[model samples]
Target chain A: MRRVVITGQGTINALGRNVAETLQAMRDGRCGIGDLEFQDVERLSIRIGAQIKGYEPEDSFNRQQIALYDRFTQFTLLAAREAIGQSGLSFSGELATRSGVILGTSGGGMNTLDENYRSVYADGKNRVHPFVVPKLMNNAAASHVSMEWNLKGPSFTVASACASSNHAMGQAMQMIRTGMADVMITGGSEAMLCFGGIKAWEGLRVMSKDACRPFSANRNGMVQGEGAAVFVFEDYERARTRGADILAEVVGFSMTSDAADIVMPSKQGASRAIAGAMQDARLNPEDVAYVNAHGTGTTANDKTECAAVADAFGHHADDLMISSTKSMHGHLIGGTGAVELLACIMALREGVIAPTIGYEEPDPECALDVVPNVARDVKVNAVLSNAFAFGGLNAVLALRAA
Target chain B: MSDSIKDRVIAILAEQAMLEPGDVSMDQSLEDLGIDSLGLVESIFAIEEAFDVSVPFNANDPTEGDFDISSVKAIIEAVTGLVATQAA
Candidate 1:
């Protein structure tokens, strides 16, 4: 199998708009969870979320494009443009046909659904926008990215709840490893921080209204975050031949299912995915220096994930550095794993560990040394990114320094 | 009115458990009613919306929560007190 590597990365989330700004925000341990600005905010029992501030879509897209693009699609395209721009790849004939786009987004066009539903239910509108169907489809973002880049290869979206992005990237890696695609624009996006989105999640009662403090004993619950992170994955040999600046090497990936419960996380399932990722990479437990923990701040996820890490790494778990960037950026749902993967790249390339910010009191069940509140400056060679979704679907990706 | 509150709570729990009100015993634990964690959380949301009073139950550590869920009777008592406090 051929090696796959990340050539470029870009993101627009609660923390920052792009990779540089996001890396700086992570290094500074900034909290992006705050008051959400949208229609009918008071109706939601869970009011606050990690909504992107100062985002003016009109500045990026024109009137026609805005009407055709939903918020999720817009986020994906914007992040994709940034990633493609950084990669300096101009897709044309064979290259364009060989490359593809795969983005993960749970609520593909949630805002569109909210607005169209409001029009009929609340405003009593007889007719809705004709482009509503095109605007709201799950594959809209992937299609747009493929069209914009002129990619004729496999392009689709992955919807696996919170693990969507990791699943998408994993598939893209396989496509490249097997010579199915020379380059793939893969990542995830979400724009579910709307009234309907929060209202639906509020019913589950897993949301925290105030803060997102992962692994903290007094942590109320996970706060919803929305945004997108796109990365350009290319064949390692091709990237090296082209003299491209490699971000990090995608060494291994593994996905597992719990088959136990729907919402409740399984320690054994998560452990299997974690251990499987290292085995796929052909790396020993000690070789992994850092882990971008899934750490959703919910009680079930935090405790179960900690136990899984213990089971996976055994004694190595004690000294291993793990932090959930969700503490700062909040949980991005389907797109979360993609954004968290940025932390892995940063750790492996920059030798700086993003802290699990907003940490206070630690629980005995979560005994791992959670890098709390402050980013650590240390040399790290390899990193692991973990994504455990609601339905016990766990996906882990292992990366090495470029 | 207190009996009505208890009945409404029972009805919500019943709806979640997919059982009849007669089948749901106030003395039975949530587990005995076949209400798992998700069911319990949904029941809390339904109760909150029905009464317009926020329940202090935490999904993370239910033991530390001020609202009790030991049994149907306990949930009823907790909801009744919360409703009473809201009314006052």
Candidate 2:
């Protein structure tokens, strides 16, 4: 089996548009949650969201392409551009055939759906937009990315809710390890801050009215966020021969499902997923230093996740430096895992753990360090990124410093 | 207009599209704002619940239900028309 490593990474979120800016924002302990103002959410009691500001679709695609794609696809393309550019590899000839794209998204083309719905129903118009199907499908982002980048091998989208991206990455690593593909572009994107989307979340009643405060005693609930994160994964020897800048090694990945509940999370499922990843990497729990928690800031998720960590690592749970980058970026739903993975790679490379901001009071149920409010500089060797989604989907990835 | 009728229209818009009072106007077109076709159908259900009246639908063309449903005025017109015919 061949080993896989992340040669390049790119991200766009409430914090920044690229890896450098995003990492800097995380280090500076910035919170991206703010009042939601998308021209239609004036009545909803919950208004705050981590929206990506100043992004234009025209900047990433041509006029014809823009008409075919939605905001979520635009985000995927922009993040893919950054990842491929950073990787310094071109898909010119056979490379294009061998390379593939895998992306995850939950709110695929919701914004487009919102627009077309208004045109047909509210306006009493019979004519629908031309790109409605292409825009609204959940796989549209992956399809757009593959077509834009000319990736022909095994391109598809994964939708495991919040765990979608991590599951996509895990599948990409397996494909390479099993000699299925030579190279893969994997990540996730979301653009669900539209008025209709926000209203849908309001019914769930898990949104934080003030701000997202994960692992804090005063935690309310998660603040919705939007953006994309992508990574270039190549075989280790292939990357080394090309003199590519290796960011981190994809040592192991694991996924598990808790057949327990629809919305409620389970510690057993989360713990098993983490342990399974560690076993896959052939590393003990002690080898893992930093943990990027799911940490959705909800009353149940935070406490349940903390218990899972403690159950997985035993005594090391108290000492392990865990933090939820979601506290900074808010929950990106499907894109959350991919962005959190970028934070893991950064933590492993820079030897600094990003803090879980908005952690005011410590929840007695969540007793982990959580790297609370301030970034910590430490010599980290390996990191774990955890993503647990609704309906009991759980995925975990283990990365080591290259 | 009866207070119940006005309240029913407002309530339908608020519940179906998650709109607030300031964001919605009786004369405003729903298309100009953001409520889509799915939103319109959902709003119809909300209207039924609010006014204890079931708006008639054209079973032949399901798509017709979504067209021209922009403002509360348009919705009221559609619903009142249906109610009058049903009474007759």
Candidate 3:
């Protein structure tokens, strides 16, 4: 089997607009979550979210381009441009034919949907935008990304709620390993910080009005966030032959379903994914030095995740560092795992463990070393990123230092 | 007045456990009655709704919760105490 390596990474999240800025924000433990300023903010119960404030669409896209690009699609194109630029690969011939774009997004075009809905219902307009269907499709981001970069192979989108990105990347890695593609543009993007998005989540009673304090005892719930993170995954041999700058190695991935509940997380199911990733990577429990947890700060998620970690790693659970950057970036939902992978890459590349900010009190149930409150400078060999979404779907990705 | 809290809580627990109310002993833990984490949380929600009182039961650390649930008896006692306090 061929080995897959990440050659480039880029992001435009509430934390920052690029990899460097995002990593710096993580190191500083800055909270990007704040008051969400959008239309009809006063009508919602939860007005706070991690929004990319002051973003001008015109700055990135022209008027004609903006008409077709939804907020989520715009995020995808911006992140993809940076990632492909860093990858230094101008695809043509077989590379272009084999390479493809696979992205994860729950809300493909929330801004578009909300706008069209208001135009038709609230404003009493008879007709809405003609391209509403194309703009609002879940695969719009992936399709535009492929068209923009000329990636003509195996392009698609994954929509397993929060686990979407990890699942999408896992599939991309497998395609490369199986010699289907030498290069893949893979990751996820989400822009759900809108009135309709928040209004829908308000019914679930899971949105936090003020903050996201994952793994903290006093944590209320997860706060919504909007952004995208895209990566360049290439075959290790090709990258090495071309003398490319490898960021990290994608070693293992596994996904599992609880088959028990729709909303509440399952400890056994989560444990299986974690243990399965280690097994697939041919790694012992001790080989993992860090974990980017799916710690959503909700009592059900935090406790269930900690229990799953303990069950999978046993004694090592006490020693290995684990943290939830959701505390800082808020929960990006479908795009969360893609952005959280940045924390893992930084950990392996720079030996910096991003902290779970806003941790005021500790609960024994979540007794792992969460690297709370501040970043830590520690050498890490291998790390795991956990994405446990609603509906009991869990995906775990394991990566090693390049 | 507080005596009714125990019966109501036990009934809620029995429903969650999918067992008869009379079969729910005060000594049996929720786990002993086959009540999983989901059941426990749902039971808490139901109890809170039925009693019209907030139960400080942390799903993360049930043992350390403000409302006790060591056993069916403890949960009943906790609810009775809460009801008495609310009445006062």
Candidate 4:
């Protein structure tokens, strides 16, 4: 079995445009959630989100490419470019045949769907653009990455709602570890900040009208966000032999389903996944330092996740630092875990723990140190990133310092 | 109190609570009717549609919202007020 390591990483989110900028913002505890700007936003009761403002498609892609690529695909490509460039491994010959790509996305081309729906239904147009199907498909981002990088091996997209990225990355790690592939270009992307996207989510009544204040007693609900984060996962020996900069080690991943309610989370299910990930990594609870929580700021999620963490770590839960970066970047849905994974890597490499910002009133249920409202400087050996999505799907990933 | 509004509210609550309209009483609270958070939200939406008046509600803190769900009568009063205001 081959050991997997993350050789390169890239991201573009509400907080920043690239890895450096994003990490710096995390260190600064900056909040990217604010007033959402999109069509029919004024009509929505919840009119705020962590949208990537001032982004122009024309600047990154030609007219034809823009027409063919959806916003989510574009974001994935941009992050993939940075990640693959950082890895410095060209895809050709045997390497290309042995490498692959897998990306995660919930609303694959929501913007494209929203536009075409409007064209046919609202605007009374008879036909939509010819590329609409290809642009809006769920596998578009993964397919584009495979084509762009010439990854001739396995390629697909995973969609498990919010846990899509973690599942996708976990699959990539398994592929490399089992000698299924030499390298896997993997991560997640989401651009669902469009009118139809927000409007659909608004019906759920789980969105905050203002900020995402995870773990705060005053927290109302989750704020939506949009972005992408991509990474290169290669065999550890291969990366070391090539002198590639290893970001973090792909250690362990565990996924669980509650088999309970669809929208509600189960503490037992989450705790199982948390404990299972640690068991898989052969890491004791004390060995872990920080946990990037799936704190969605919702009345149910924040408390439920806190309870799960406490149950999994037992007494050590009191000593460990757990923070939700979603408080800063907002919940990116399927793309969230990948962006949140950046915080885990930062804790391992930079010794900086991202804070759970917007903390005000203390939540007795979430009594653990949330590292509230201010970044902390701490060297950590192992960290866990948790992603629990709707439908009771839970995926927990463990990483060690490289 | 408008009789039609009361009847319509009771019908909506009954539908959501999965009970007979006759079983719902003005003294009964949403909890008494077995209306959970999701059911309460759906009831609110139904009430707003029935009267064609927007109900200012945020499920984050149901108590903080202007709409009152303390009891059936309280909800009727809030809806009546909203309906009158919209008519004005």
| Clash counts for all predictions | 0, 8, 0, 0
- Model 1 chain A: lowest-lDDT 10 consecutive positions: A201-210
Q: List the residue pairs that clash in candidate 2.
A: A117-B36, A117-B37, A118-B36, A121-B66, A124-B67, A124-B68, A217-A361, B30-B70
With a 3 Å backbone cut-off (N, CA, C), the pairs that clash in candidate 1 are: none
Candidate 4 pairs with clashing backbones: none
Q: Please, what are the lDDT tens digits per residue for candidate 3 over residues B1-88?
A: 3557778888999888889999999899988989986687788778767877666654544554478777999889888777667657
Instruction: Report fnat, model 4.
Output: 0.45
Provide all candidates' interface root-mean-square deviations: 1.6, 16.8, 4.8, 1.3
Least lDDT summed over 10 consecutive residues: which range in candidate 4 chain B? B56-65
TM-score, cand. 4: 0.98
For candidate 1, the iRMS in Å is 1.6
**Winning candidate number (TM-score):** 4
Give the distance in Å from residue A143's predicted Cα in candidate 3 to where it truly belongs: 0.5
DockQ, ranked from best to worst? 1, 4, 3, 2
Candidate 2 Cα errors over 4 Å, as ranges: B1-88
Candidate 2 chain A minimal-lDDT segment of 10 residues: A201-210
lDDT of 3 at A14: 94
lDDT of each: 0.92, 0.85, 0.91, 0.93
The sequence of per-residue lDDT tens digits that candidate 3 reaches over residues A159-203 is 999999999999999999999998999999999988999998865
lDDT of 3: 0.91
